[model samples]
Target: MRLLFLTNRANALRARISNTFTLPERFKGTVVEKWAKYWTGLVRDYKDVGVDVVKFGYNKPRKALVITGASLGLYACVKRNPDEEVFLQLLRQWNNKLILVSPTEQNVIAKEYVRDLELVLNRNTLRTLSLGFCTLLWVDLYSKDDCTYKAICEYTGVDYLKFYQYIIDIGFWNRYWRLDWKMRNFDINYL
Candidate 1:
């Protein structure tokens, strides 16, 4: 199945540890092996489930898309939209899905993103966009920050964290992973 995994790029706005220190400056005099390993671990998790994960660079298409950042990566994909059909095509899949594994902190741009998406994308399409290709809404989020998390809950009205707990209760991820993997083999237009 085709899957798109979008996460924060190191060059993203928050690349710096904070305003007080830049990313490079923060990592100065230290090896980045552990940092690399953390991302590698996320990739390995997908690999463990037999889903291929890409780093949001390069020009390749997967059967499913899994984006993890609420900042730039999410903004870029949403801005590109169905015109960037390669990604949109994957997003259009019945089992096509999106996941926002974002930091709790709010960025000004992200606030605007939520507003823009709500204004432009129709409820059905937004729900469909939230759902994968299966004619259902299937968006999910994993966040620890309360303010932004609360904002997401208010916007989607899904009580994301609670929903996630329920998913865990039902083993949702594993089942969805398998279902999506099977769904990935079909044509994008097959419906």
Candidate 2:
């Protein structure tokens, strides 16, 4: 069972899998440590249940994409048959550097990630990404000013004052010690 991710060194977007998470900014003291322990424990819950969570990041195939002739041929096949497995199989042939999770877990994990990430990400995006993985996938709000941050919080469906600590903790999603989430934010960036 394996989960595959397309990534590049210069830009590790966290991609669609993490789109549902609300990652936190750098924080102080033991704040992050506590949150990390909580997040780790949460993930451990599923692993103990026989779920092997493996996320493999493979660089986008630069040479193949640049070669117009081959790309066209590949594109045609994908267009003709829109099966996801076909696309995944082609991906496997393109890169030898990979760590495959059990394919059996793909659908199940993708689904469970939505429910479980709600707890881990603990913050929702204004809506599902309109562009999905096509856009930059920063999980945390980058606004520095209060007003701007407030607007972002609005879209994320969190009350600024209420989630302030959870949003800016040294740990992104602190479950214990930090204040409890009043509204219970949820995200699916890792699915």
Candidate 3:
């Protein structure tokens, strides 16, 4: 989920959500509602895939993703480099993930990430809403065979048998791979 720019989506992912998904529902017949209705299905797709969005989880795999995903940012921040785009992007991704998991997860977004988010939202309703929306979209489009997926698996030190079992239990992994997915049905032991 932390992989930057997960999909092009014709560069419309921002418009699809900030312009609609995260907004409170309007009248049923309103144009916004219609657009939101269409996005609801797609947005929901990413959330169910189960990848750790950015770096928000309290588990090993999640922590690994954060460490690996934000490595560049962390390095840049520590070095006090003049250009900290990677570090800034890391903050934005982490902060956005926090928004989606909030009310239980404490928000740790620094002033910088807030400014970055504000710049993206352009003074729209609730920056948190857009952050949450973007977070879901990032995870939604993740595929098991993608290079990012391999990196996460390598970092997580995934047990093929167990990971495959988890996918089967959940009605097939959110996204399949070229390798055979046949696995005996069994209870999952996920991290």
Among all candidates shown, the one with the greatest lDDT? 3
Residue-wise C-alpha lDDT for candidate 2, range 137-190, written one tens digit per residue = 223443333356555564664445654333321111112111122112222223
Q: Assess every candidate by TM-score.
A: 0.16, 0.17, 0.18
Q: Candidate 3 local accuracy as lDDT? A: 0.39
| Candidate 3 least-lDDT 10 residues | 129-138
Give the higher-lDDT candidate: 1 or 3: 3
On TM-score, the stronger of 2 and 3 is 3
Candidate 1 lowest-lDDT run of ten: 166-175
Quick one: how many clashes does candidate 3 have?
1
Query: For model 1, how does the per-residue alpha-carbon lDDT over 121-149 read when each residue is reduced to its tens digit?
Result: 34322332323222223333433232465
lDDT of the candidates, in the order given: 0.38, 0.36, 0.39
Worst 10 residues of 2 by lDDT: 169-178
| lDDT of residue 60 for candidate 3 | 66
Model 2: how far residue 181 lies from native, Å: 28
Q: Give the runs in model 1 whose Cα sits over 4 Å from its true position.
A: 1-75, 81-136, 139-160, 165-180, 185-191
